[model samples]
Target: MGEDHMERLIEGHKRFLAEVFPGRKSQFHLLAETQAPEWLFITCSDSRVLPDLILGTGPGDLFITRNAGNVVPLTSQDVDGCTATIEYAVEVLRVKHAILCGHSDCGAMKAALDRAGLDALPKARRWLQHVEAAFAHRQPVNSAEGESAELASLIRGNVVAQLWNLKAQPSVVRAVDEGRLTVHGWYYDILSGRIEEYDEELRKFVVLGE
Candidate 1:
């Protein structure tokens, strides 16, 4: 079975080399030399949250970082993976927009909402501690999000929580202060395939397009 999967991957690579790569050879060649992505997208590792598909982006367009729950750790001494990546994107890549995007029905948020299954996963439990701050930032439940209102509220709150943490990074703070970076929090509904941006001024989630 594994061999069959490997064969399929090989076949796919061949298809890319033959059919896909040729049409975009120049684009790939430029990317081979260097990448100067403008948007730093921080999102969940959920298979459903395809940033490229949802944002209509392709290779070299976005500098992406992903982890369960889309977490940004809040420790001054500890250099977590998420923060390290943000520092690089800001200081080196010089990305202009840093977006923290969370999604509906996220397993990480579900795990956070219920600690029943937490014992089996020690690392995950510890990592989700970052989400505790989300409770304080929870947006009022939106009926539009349906029966999973509690979960959806927490998800939006997590986006806001992480967005602040992203801002707290020294590099991010400097970038923003120097007028080099902008930060955003976003909630994506997998069922409806719609995205909402958290309006910091209004303190509410609004349609991303609007």
Candidate 2:
């Protein structure tokens, strides 16, 4: 079974090299030399959340960083991958926009809600502690989500909390103050295939393109 899955991936790579690569050879050649992506996308490791597919962005468009819960850990004595990526994206890449996006039906959020199983996964338990603030920032429950409404609310709240952490990064703070960067918080609903951007002024999530 494992070999079959590996073969499938190998075949997919073969197809990309033979069919897809030729059409975008020039783009790849240029990207290989250097990348000047304008957006810094921080999102979850969830397989269902494909930033390129949903945003219609290809390579060289977004500088991306991913973790289990889409976290942007607050600056501290200890350096984490997420914060280090954010610092580089802001200071070195000079990305114009930084997007902190969380998705619905997230397993990370599920584990956060019920930590009984976390005892077996010590590393994950420690990592999820970053999302504990989500409980305080929970959004108003939406009836449209049915039984998953509460979970969705918590997920959105995580987006907000992490967005705050993203902004707190020293590089991000400097970039924003210089009027060169903008930060956004987003909740992606896999079921509806819709994205909601948090409105800082209104303090609510509004559907993207609406």
Task: Give candidate 2's error at residue 35 in angstroms.
Answer: 0.4
lDDT of each: 0.92, 0.92
- Indicate which candidate wins on TM-score: 2
Against the hidden reference, what TM-scores do the models get? 0.96, 0.97
Model 1 scores a TM of 0.96
What is the Å distance of residue 180 in model 1 from its true position? 1.0
> What is the alpha-carbon lDDT for the whole of candidate 1?
0.92
Could you give candidate 1's per-residue lDDT for residues 1-210 as a string of tens digits? 599989999999999999999999999999998999999999999999999999999999999999999999887467778888999999999999999999999999999999888999998988998899998888886787654889988999999999988889899999999998999999999999999999999999999988
Error of 1 at 2 (Å): 2.5
Instruction: Give the C-alpha lDDT of model 2.
Output: 0.92
